[model samples]
Target: MTAAAPRPLPEWTASAVSPLDAKLGLELLEVSPERAVGRAPVAGNTQPFGLWHGGASCVLAESLGSLAAHAHALTLDLVAVGVDLNATHHRSAREGWVTGTATALRLGRTLASYEVVLTGDDGQRLCTARLTCSLVPPRR
Candidate 1:
């Protein structure tokens, strides 16, 4: 049998808020089960050295990955909670926005994983990250 096409993500307003995301000035461009895209401005997210903070990159990566995983879980009548996240900083972003794209690596009944790549405006990789989430029944 042919593999089934992936289901389209449900309609969701782009108003999901996280205090850390807001503090870092992250803007969500798209959110879906297949992928999640967002950008964080460097102005407010920089470290004392004037470079983008590695922690900020991790926050962006986790935000995208978790959002995508959660979206995927919704299709199965489940909820997702991030169980693990990690990031390796490849380079520093001194100016402009850093864009993050989270692509699903695996989507299953009880688990989901995504790889998130953060890049500078010039399209150079700044960080690589992975996030795994546990899918579970929604709490009553």
Candidate 2:
């Protein structure tokens, strides 16, 4: 007999993702359980001082990390919820897009963690962040 077709991946529509993601102009470039990438414009996500907002960096970091965690959780018929998030701002960006790359640090049965690095267009590190998500059964 022919092999069964592979299951389809989750579709990330605007409505399916966080509304804040749209508000911040964040766009997902890549997605997987091991890694995820996203970008946001520096113009609208700036602080009052005209520098990139640290909170925005945290948001991007958590978003990417959670995305990866969710992907992993899906395989186990579970859902992921972010439990903790930490970020360190190393520098500031005033222009161009801010890119965030998330690499999985751990993907355990109960939890998932990832480290996300936010960079400028010129490749300078703007911030570093870590996120942890707890996996749980989906509500019926």
Candidate 3:
């Protein structure tokens, strides 16, 4: 007997993958088990003070991290669900775009972890986040 091949991951599209992501203007540029990249505009995702909303950063971080974990989980015919997320906003962005890069910290049989960095268009670090997801069989 031979090991079965991993299932092909569905193509990630802003509108198709998540409604919140589409509303927040998030775009996934790349995705893999070890890494994922995404970006969102800061124009509408701002606080009352007109600065980039910290919550938006967290959303992007979790999205990328979860996507990467899901990619890994697919290899085992499992699904990934977010278990924990933590984010620290270091700076604020008033305009332009924010890019998030998620780097896998651990890819395991039961869980996956990633460190996500959100950067401004100027290449300045704006936020750092960590996310963990649990892998399990998909519910029928």
Q: Looking at model 2, report the run of 10 residues with the lowest lDDT sum.
A: 6-15
Instruction: For residues 40-81, write the lDDT of model 1, one tens digit per residue.
Output: 899988889999999999999998898898889989999889
What's the CA RMSD of model 1 in angstroms?
A: 4.9
Q: How do the candidates rank by TM-score, highest first?
A: 2, 3, 1
| Residue ranges of candidate 1 with Cα displaced over 4 Å | 1-15
Clash number for candidate 2 = 0
Give lDDT: candidate 2, residue 60: 91
How high a TM-score does candidate 3 get? Answer: 0.90
lDDT of each: 0.89, 0.89, 0.90
Show where candidate 3 strays beyond 4 Å.
1-16
lDDT per residue (tens digit) for residues 30-82 in model 2: 77889888899999999999999999999899988998898889889999999
- Return model 3's CA RMSD, one decimal: 6.6
TM-score of each: 0.89, 0.90, 0.90
